[model samples]
Structures are given as structure tokens and as C-alpha cells.
Target: MQITASTVSLTVDDVAASRAFLTTHLGYTVQAAADGFASLTRTDAVDIVLLARGTEVLPPEQRDQHATGLILAFTLDGGLQDQEKRLRDAGVEITMPLREEPWGERLFQITDPNGVIIQFVEWVTPDDV
Candidate 1:
């Protein structure tokens, strides 16, 4: 089967808080929203759906579960440093400072208002490693 798109649904304590954080800081646009739900989208990233914990739209067994132990990671084409700098300039606390690994992977992380861990990564050329 061909997958046209992808989406990640996160159950948070405050849907509005997570929605605002994504749109305001992570360049996501609101696809749809209601009292306790929000669908956020971006051209270069996966779609994100924020559902308030306990929302009935979720399965009964999952409705009360909160998003945890997950890192929403995005691999970028380039400009990892500039992106981190811009986020820092916007007063976003970098939860994980930008660092490069021996395998040429560079990454950093920030936590959204709902405590969702968002990570950005970029890989360097072998020559630059």
C-alpha cells in the first residue's frame, strides 16, 4: 500500500498549550481544531494531532494515557545550527544542547509545553566528520 502521508497523535494534558507551542515555535499550521483537539501540519514535517487526555475521541483504553517517553525527531536537509540559534533567539530553552556525534550526526532537542520532546537532526559529510 502506498502511504500518502503520515501523522502522529499525541495525548496531552493541555491540547491548546501543545497546539500553541507547535504553531508558534515549530512552524506548524492549524489544519483543524476544536475544544480538545487540534490537527497541525507543516510542508516539511509530519502532521501532528494534539488530543487532550481523556478525550472521548480516543479509544477507551488510550484516552487516559499521556504522551511520554517519545521524541518527535526530524532530520533536516541542512542549517541545523542556524535553526538552533533562531530557536534560542526566540527564548526557547534547548533541552539538549546541539552536539555532533562521531558518526557525523548532529542533533539538539527542545521540550514543548506539554513536555513532548522534539529533536532536530542533521548529518555532516564524511569529509567534515
Candidate 2:
């Protein structure tokens, strides 16, 4: 079986607020919005979706108790600096600041209002060609 495009979706509290934050701050466009549910699309190559709830959203669980440390990461062609600037301009909170590691990857993290962690990274190496 061949898996094509996919998205991680979840209902969120305050659909309008989430919509505004994602669209205005993240450079995402509205793919669909109505009836208390909103779907957004990322402008980049990946078709990432952000879904907001129609009714009251769930409150965040107590940290270290949730037991799930799931995070989404994307390697940007422009690297960490560009994405850091983009996230900053969009008013997203930086959960983890960018720092170089011994693995030759520059990475940073940000969290959405719903607490989804998004890491933007770039690989570093000397280019001979």
C-alpha cells in the first residue's frame, strides 16, 4: 500500500481563536472553515492541517502524566534561522530555543495553543558541489 498525503488532526478549544492564530501567525491558509470547525493548510510542500473543535475543547492534561511525548518535526530547506524568524514573526511561543548539536543539526521548537510541538530543523554539512 502506498501512503500519500496525510495530516494530524485534532479538535481544539476556541475554534476562532485557533483559526486566527494559525492563519495569521503560521502563514497557513483556510482550506475549509464553517460550522465551528476550521481546517488550515500549510504553504510549504507538506500538506499539514490544523483542525479546531466545534464545541468546547479539552483542557490540557497534567504534564508528565499524559505519558505521551509526541512531537512533529520538519526539516526546512532554509534552515533553523529562517523558520525561527518566521515563527517569531507569527507570534508563536518558542518552547525551545535553537542550538547546534554534535549531530550536525540545528533545531528549535515551538508549541501551538493546543500544545502540539513543532520543531523546525536543518542539516548542516560542507558542500563540495
lDDT of 1: 0.94
TM-score of 2: 0.68
Would you give me the overall lDDT of model 2? 0.66
> For all the candidates, what are their Cα RMSDs to the real structure?
1.6, 5.4
How many clashes show up per model? Answer: 0, 1
What does candidate 2's lDDT look like per residue over 11-121, in tens digits?
555557666766776677888877666677775645444434434343444311321266767887765687787778867788999887776778899876666676788
Mark the regions of model 1 whose C-alpha exceeds 4 Å error after superposition: 126-129
Q: Specify the highest-lDDT model's number.
A: 1
lDDT of residue 27 for candidate 1: 92
